[model samples]
Target: MINNHMLKRKLDWDYRQRCIYMTTVTVEKRRPLLGQLTGGLGNPTVELSDVGIMVAQCWQEIPTHVPGVSLLEWQVMPDHFHGIIFVQAPQEKPLGAIVGAFKAHSTSLYRAGARQEAHLWSPGYQDTILLHRGQLANMRAYIQDNPRRLAVKRAHPELFRIIRNISACGHIFAAIGNHFLLDAPVKRQVQISRSVPPDALAAAEADLLAAALHGAVLVSPCISPGEKQIARAALQAALPLIVILENGFPPLYKPPKSYFDACAAGRLLMLAPWPHHTDRRSLTREQCLALNRFATQIAQEDHTP
Candidate 1:
């Protein structure tokens, strides 16, 4: 039986709709047969191995085999691949079918060339549906810059790394995104979203301040103008905050001036699930919603007794 912790993709969701899709597939056992990551901190590059070159060629040919699918940005890493695919029209096959076909073809070619019969790909993959154009741009930049981030992580694993299942204040949170660590236990955390109205923003800000007065951590993505105001207020008041970001944290990342003191006080945590992009300036609607969902999840998990 599949562990309940593993979430199956929505089987009933329609994939024929015209939209942008992102998917990631890793090699079996995460072997670094695809490429070698090299270069310095800000200018990392990927040197494709023999297998990596084949993977790239196969990825480029995905659009040719898959009807109604157009390839966007993609990257072949040391042991994984990240690609953006756009479904331009309705099709008989869904996104999963296209991915499966690509995987099968790639695996066959790889095994035949390498003279190995072992499985080439791990089971299942990670995917996301882009809701708007902003997200597409963000994802494109992210895919293009994976090697640079990987290089930095490899060079400085102690400074920039993914820490899994961190427990704070009786709550378990994973640092999969760009985040800074705070060692405080969370108390009275509240969810703040971009959709809150102006009047509601004031009330929410007041409530957040009151909660802070009573020692509560403010959790939010702070993407909207209104939500940002609350975050600014929380920073000024020296209240603990858990800010969810849309992009990955850069190497030796530090909080902004507004939140510097709070971070220094060990009352701030920033979380993201994306790799650091060198030129990301905006967040897409889909990214905002996802971060808000994460914020809500964090709030729900902060159930301190």
Candidate 2:
């Protein structure tokens, strides 16, 4: 199951509304009792253990037990389960209650069969409530590829690891992705102001992309719209990049799919000097300026003699 380092729910969101949610329920202590990934990276498949199969069966019965819950897609991973479900409007229970019932029922079944663990799942689940149809489609693709992705990570552990206490640009950070990106001799900071016009922003991005193509590591705080657009473009072009963040990495931290793939390819380095936080954060003006300054420092420190 995904870690609940992120909040259980959106801070002020109404859980009663009709929403599409992707939830992750992890096994207690992350035991691989559910299943194993087979067929290798070439043709990955989840070979469900007996318990895994039973748990999956229980997942299928959630709708029958909980009204206003529709199961869209689900994958029972070796250590945790990922499910995409739609909670309809005018519901009898919120998303948490529905998930709680499923967990309770599954544990009962597991215990009835004389399982060792008192509980099958961890205390709570992590949820991602999709905002739009585009996000929903991307989540579907993510769930479908979960097995293959896990297989690939198993094949290459070093690239996907979270390494703490990394020293770079006279600062310490908890970092994920290729730490080696910091060593590039031609690192250039991309500092675009929010006030830049569309045309100038386009030009600035093009210049950065050209430099990236010529073996320069592009660094950015990625706070401003222009910077964000350029950063996205840089990743799309598969160039090396270093991103500065205000928040640090949490335990069992994994980057999103785009960043994950970039990390696997050793083309990205994300650095955060501050400690990790679970609460949703809004960037203060002071923090934004400080992070932008950090990008400049990171780039300057990497310049070769």
Candidate 3:
């Protein structure tokens, strides 16, 4: 039988595989000793400190130290690093061992150099197994834009701050981005089915865009393709939007670039009724119904005092 602890944390996959992985290794106690985020809004970059430089150098040497593992890309931030590692050939060492060795070596260097901290990194790095097409491109773009995104979030902290105990409609949710968008007088749920044809979807999206232009907040789970289209249109139009997510917000969660831009513009709100989790899960039928119902309830109820 699988233990609860294993269920919560383990991926249940053979670690020795030729797989591509995206990993995030954070600094101990979330310190910003890695580097300073510098430059203007249009052109932001990380000015790596001595510690940050050492971390980058160690990361670059991973391929040399770990057999059959090669580096794809990496970005060093104020408190953490995001990197993509390609295991082109199966190695005796698992991903965890590889990351562990990297951390151990980095700590040894820190100590040898007489750094104040006993260790450089926190325990247990987070890894995402890249299994789908286009995911690599997306992750690469995400890694590339970390500096700029961090700059935007820092500049507009109010828009991206997580606000809890947000009572909307009949339910309560934790939220991020433009909470005042909740108070908008008019809101409509974008409920487009998967069966919707392309032409029909375009027409429906157009109608929703018209409503959004007339000061309406478009709420959606963004489940189906049509729903995604509608949400994308609303975002492109720079109108108010409310998205009901299946999973709750992670503590250090930052919205992706597209959503980040909308949040920075004070036009987006992501609502989550569930607690945060790390496990990858499929959307069950029950979850779909609940989210759709939640979206409808949010749209119908008035949030204004």
Candidate 4:
């Protein structure tokens, strides 16, 4: 089994910029790599030359329905596949939607022929949006060198270049066309407000505030002068404040600090359910829920005594 390290960088979803992204997906174990990779030295058991070709075509077709898109370097590894998918923001769908389409269509084909209900691939995939020039080059190099790293010395890299062109940055390269993909709609900046009774609002606010303080990046809900004061205090203490307001109402006031990162140590909290700590830190969802339940049980017992 391969030992993987804990992923470090957290991607801030930018809804306004279209960016090039690299996605790594893996196949189910006990399945031969032959079907995934083909035309390489040291033949794989389940030669997927046909499947890889089909997927490559699918990657190209993605841009037709989705605007501002292109395919860069891609390879089908024995147990995994790495591909650079480009997306121009403000297009037809989210990046996840694109991945889902690939996964769904490919799985259907694999299932119908394989006649096995076993998982076709792993559930989680890794995606990184190229935020800067250095990162973009790194992603392209990674995809291009995958053949050599996988010990396929006989493979030719140029065969995989379905698209390539010169970049205006004075460097010619293969990247999903230049366009900033908008951040897809996600649950961020939650609001709790005056629509509810002030008392309930306070309680809900406290719950959300507590959740954020305990590691949620929730902004404050109210924009009142008092709320802004509270936000200022929380930032001073290095707590991330979730800016909130009653539904459809502008913030009555803005907080003193304009920069959120300056308030915290660049620590962004993960979004999770109640009793669910964000997975941003090391703890898993199960571990978080279990520990909380256990603590609650002990507290209940002490109260009875």
Candidate ranking (TM-score, best to worst) = 2, 3, 1, 4
Which residue ranges in model 1 land beyond 4 Å of their true spot?
A: 1-7, 159-305
Q: Report the error of model 4 at residue 41, Å.
A: 8.5
Per-residue lDDT of 42-138 in model 3, one digit per residue for the tens? 8899999998899899999998887789999899999988999999999887888888888898889988887565867776777778999999999
lDDT at position 25, candidate 4: 68
Residues 200-293 of candidate 1: C-alpha lDDT, one tens digit per residue: 8788789878977786677887777877887888778777788777776543353444454454355677676566665426778887777777
Better of 1 and 2 by TM-score: 2
lDDT of 2 by residue, 1-305 (tens): 44565336776877777989999888888889899989998999999998899999989998887777799999999989999889875575678887888888888988888656577887788899898769988988999988888987888788778788899778788888888888889888999988999999999999999999999999998998899899999999999999998888877677787887888788999988898888878999999888988888888884465
Top TM-score: which candidate number? Answer: 2
TM-score of each: 0.61, 0.93, 0.91, 0.42
Worst 10 residues of 1 by lDDT: 1-10
For model 4, what is the C-alpha lDDT against the true structure?
A: 0.46
What value of lDDT does candidate 3 attain over all alpha carbons?
A: 0.86
As for model 4, its CA RMSD to the true structure in angstroms is 20.2
Query: Candidate 2: lDDT of 54?
Result: 90
